[model samples]
Target: MSTMPTLDTPVTLTISPDGGIDGRSRRYEKFLGDMAGVYRDAEAWQAAVSARGADELVYWVDDHRYQEGPGALIVGTSTLLPGRIGDEFAVTRGHLHAIADRAELYHCLSGHGVMLLETVDGQSMAVELTPGKAVNVPGHWIHRSVNVGDEPFVTLFCYAADAGQDYALIADAGGMKSLVVADGDGWMLTPNPDHTGYRKA
Candidate 1:
């Protein structure tokens, strides 16, 4: 068997101006109109978002063993585009931990946004995010983040190495029941009708 890398030296990770963790970083992009029915005005939003070319970006560390399970620690940053999807703002593709009891932690390093969380049993909530803010995601909840400001939303995340993300669970549920969007001078929290409950803006 191969030995693990020696820890005799400091392992340095660079954060790009946009909050990307350098060195073999992987990026996933989502255009503004990506999530079709997740918004109130689907067709209108799709046309508007597409015309603006707004896109969200998720940057992940290039370590190959993250999905291997057990002791692996996965960390990365998601830079949500500074725009809206109908009444919703730019957001990450949320996911539930493949290992049900695996929790995750997220630190907001830059920008303004909120972390939307929900459990399979119907509990839902949101945590506002600003520079230096951090939030914990319980193992039983599926979560995602939204950029509700005029600038890019960036946040760093850490989770158990063995905890894999189940994106289909979130997609199948039609996304979180609530959304964060720009509200004139600040931001607004609104409801996503696709999900069961309604949250007023």
Candidate 2:
């Protein structure tokens, strides 16, 4: 069910290439310590925490949601710092929308990245993104961002305001089916051996 805003006023936002959302309503951040079982290389992750300290910021998001109804939209930005845990790249703790069938758009603003997308029923894809490139992610697909460059990978994103995230989907499934990994000086998509398949939400 959708509800119209009581005050139907227009809102403007300034999105920066470095992942800043000037009119964002909220800011969320994740540190190395926040990722416990997110990485396949557990030992490598642990060693990284020991070496770089667990408080190191890995990624963050800034978003603006002006209304609360299903008809409303949330515009946001994601900034992911570059690093590697074994062959795996730095990633956002991915999710499927809580509504399950809500689509989203991600446009690269800076640096390089890969949109790792997978379906609950074994379908998968890895799409590389650079400045000016975007991916229209269809509904029912779980998605995560991977930073494979030396600089911060930033993106501008927009989706239905009512489409909330279910972040535990990937963790519960033992991670996504495909991983965006290092391949020489470039990147590649490889199967995640530990994935036990998604448990439909």
Candidate 3:
């Protein structure tokens, strides 16, 4: 009599022992096709970005991730235009809103500037910032900066997070808007509105 297979010793067989190998291999081929499609899409995206010069020479740095949860993303742009002896630019200032996962940090790569930090209890202080210097803006603190130099100033800014996240909500705050600058006309605040090249010129 023929013996039946038991759980400890089961028989291994294919869908069809004769010629079903091609069909089995087709599934793997489809998976490879899907992966190739993803790679093509990524390559196309990089090409388009390169054509527009959107990611040109720029100082960009940020934390890898937050210790507790999500992290933060910080981005800054600087230009070296012709400037007089006392020309100043108010970059940004005011209440540091709490991010979901990360904190913010700033590193002054070039030029001279000042970071005015105010605590929740109404105490404020100005910290001098220079190239190669780094500052950590704690969660929920208010801060701002001013360029106090004669030449073109450059800065590198960054953000940290409890998790890997981007914290840009402060860009939408009311009092936090504008950079109060020490121009020839004394302290002047300018609206920090998002500008497009087509709209301005």
The TM-score, computed over Cα atoms with residue i paired to residue i, of candidate 3 is 0.40
- Model 1: per-residue lDDT, tens digit, 1-201? 999974433346676536676753365556554665555567866687567654633222323223445666667776776766566676777878888789988888888888988888777888999998999988888788877777777887878877777877765656576777668777777777676532221
- What does candidate 2's lDDT look like per residue over 107-188, in tens digits? 9999999999999988998889999999999999999999999999999999998899999889988988988889999989
TM-score of each: 0.79, 0.96, 0.40
Model 2 lDDT at residue 167: 93
* Prediction 2 global C-alpha lDDT: 0.93
Note the residue pairs that clash in candidate 1.
69-162, 70-162, 72-161, 73-161
Please name the candidate that would achieve the greatest lDDT relative to the true structure. Answer: 2
Q: Give the range of the ten consecutive residues with the poorest summed lDDT in model 2.
A: 4-13
For model 3, state the Cα shift of residue 35 in Å.
47
Query: Per-residue lDDT of 3-50 in model 3, one digit per residue for the tens?
Result: 974333222323321112211212211111121111113354345345
**Candidates in order: C-alpha RMSD to true structure:** 4.9, 2.6, 20.0
lDDT of each: 0.69, 0.93, 0.40
2 or 3, greater by lDDT: 2
- Between prediction 1 and prediction 2, the one with superior lDDT is 2
How many angstroms is residue 65 displaced in model 2 relative to the true structure, after the best TM-score fit?
A: 0.6
